[model samples]
Target: MGKIVFKRLVEVQILHDYFLTMGDGISFFQRNKKEKEELLTQRINRGLYSAGSIFKISPITANKLRDNKILFAETSSGFILGVEVDEVIEAGELRFKPVHDISKKLDLSFSLTTKLPFFKSFTNLELEKSLPSINYFTNKKATLLNENTVPAYTSMPLTKTAPAHQAGETYEMGTILDFGGTIREANQRTDGNDPAHWEDIDDRRFVTRADKVLLPHNFKIKFKDYQLVTQLEVSLEDTGNNKIKKIVKNSAEPFKDISLNFSKIDENDKDSPNIPSGIYYLNLKINGATEIVYSILLDNDLYDYQNFGVVELGFEEVNSPYSLLDTQGFLKTKIEAGGQKVSHPIFEIRLKNRRSYWRYKKNTDFTPSEIAATSNHLEVAASNILVAKKPKALTETLLPFKNGTNLLLPTPKVAGIRVENEKIYSDIHINQSNGLLKI
Candidate 1:
């Protein structure tokens, strides 16, 4: 009887394909029929698919279904009835792991190959926002973690320092020691004899007021994405620090080992949408000592425009035989920021004539070549001489001094003045800033 009923339900395939497929078909007929519908209703309710439905089947029934000896068919009332089956299989035999199965099944369709590039790793924010920071070891004892932070704390002890502005200057925190000495003219010279003299231009001396001296607040910055091309412009003057100053004193010792660290204080800015963006704290350290520390709110618009000055290479036509003592040449280049024109200083170069070499008037066509030759000779001569005795007793800038006052070649060292053949090159002395030689 069950087999006959199931066979009859199977014949309703036409209805199942057309209308019975709409949603839960059994529920639709329940409203139309007020009285109980007997076996049809019970089967319909029991056949609903649910997570728990699999457990309701008896072991015998499950085995019969699995073996295809008995099956179910749909009726016009959206109900299932016992029916015969033609296929038999365990469910586990057909099941598969989703990820593995999809790849294996579609490998041919997807064209599996190792040529595809794999993503290496996410962008590093810390490296991108890297900036210089003042680092130092503790000189005193520490009780806490006793490691990294302790050394830093002791070196940059949180002592209050007099404001640089107290003397009408913006001072960094902790920089309490004020070198009250007036800005004396720094002597720039070198001796050719000593290898150390080549870097003598950087040596400098300053007297500071002990009472007013204090540690400057440290400043540092870390670029979240790009590198910050840092240039230090320190002004010991009252007008404020120069952002671009080429002269690094103390054999470049004063400018060495300067560190700055920057931290994002504002995380809400769209431009700096990450951790630190709009505002940040800057930590600056010099020679393992904290110089200044302060918070700075950055304006993206600040660098929108660049302030620049044009450097023009000034040249004058002169007779080839004439001694070109130290003719200054000039070229125009621009440096700008924030759409404003910046005041550019003067440009100059110092060169000494090596010898009087005559050029044929017919060969005037080689003007560029002649200019290059003349430039090279003057450079070689200027580099070989010792210091200018008139300028200073020490050889700040060694020049190629001639034996006689005639400025001739084969010149010996002026006894009182210590001069050597340093072999300075013109290209090495060419200053990019303001486009001129200071001497």
Candidate 2:
């Protein structure tokens, strides 16, 4: 009886002609439930046709832990997914494991994530809201459970330190390091170098007093394909007001570990740029491939009067000679809360299949090639990003409020960024009272 009703529904609005058909004898369907709306995009129902080309995409704001089944289909413009999270489970500690075969490819973060049985995990949050205060551990001790309230802990002034490994040592060749210090250590983790397995390296975050000094020192960084000296430049500066000014430093480091001794530009050297001490920005220019990568550390704090910046690096692809990701290209920004503070900052942008996008931007090597971003202000063009395997359609937005606000309506909230597929729909809009929407 249920199957009869579903077949009737499929018959209600069937298309007369075929547009896309898979290898098997599956058919495509369409309806004029409002012809214009039908022309925009079609939703794939589970039982309407062969599930071969059937794609499913959940609404943008769906909680990933819901155990939603996200299967995708390929399209010329991009991929299409029909999402259904009807079988939701209780949200627990976030956990994900990278797909092994995908990792072996020249893809890093682009590696596919599978539902692995790890004990813990967390997602980057938009700046307006606090991340779920999970016990985040580094090379140190940790708390037993998740904290509901963000305890206000005072922070000590930050110090920039780089530790070099013994000479003649080589790592598995992963994310590049700026100081040539601690780059290999992150993937190696606290257990020390483990050629047995790999771990995701959390971006280093530091809180500092504006007047803190970053004394100069010598360090070594390993670059792939060529000697340490090919196409590398280091710029340290301030990026608080949404612009970049060279934080004038004098670096004459040219050899292997690229010594970085930054000193104030002298008056006699008026040509040198000047940098005031408040928040420091670290920028690195390097060639990026699947293997050769680097890391830039910045402040991941949410408190006011906090000084921070992120490490931004750019690299050229060895195969195509095209740039892959932005050098600090994707915006990781923060805004002041409405006279209130939160626990920690969430990453403003989320890129799905980030590595996959690089894999197929030029060729059709992969299927279901898509990239997803939940950001407040994202400009792919400025970053030279122009494509997403398919055109994205907004399903629904997930938003969080501040200062005990309960309502989730557009009237009171700011919609800072709206992007889909490869087109920019809405520009970033914000108010001092209400910063970019923490979506």
TM-score of each: 0.18, 0.20
Error of 1 at 87 (Å): 99
lDDT of each residue in 1-439, candidate 1, tens digit only:
2332112111111111111112222221122222222433443466632211111111213333334343433233322223322221223221111111111111000000111121001100011112221111110121121112212211111111211212221211111222232111112222112222211211011111111111122333222211122334322211234221111213232232343222222223546422222333333433233244333333322111111001111112222111111122111111233433322111111011111111112211323433343342332223322222212111112333233333421212222221122221111122233211121
Q: Lowest summed-lDDT stretch of 10 residues in model 2?
A: 4-13
lDDT of 1: 0.21
Find the number of clashing residue pairs for candidate 1.
Answer: 82
In terms of TM-score, which candidate is strongest?
A: 2
lDDT of each: 0.21, 0.24
What TM-score quantifies how close candidate 2 is to the native fold?
0.20
Model 1 misplaced regions, further than 4 Å? 1-181, 188-263, 266-283, 290-297, 304-384, 389-439
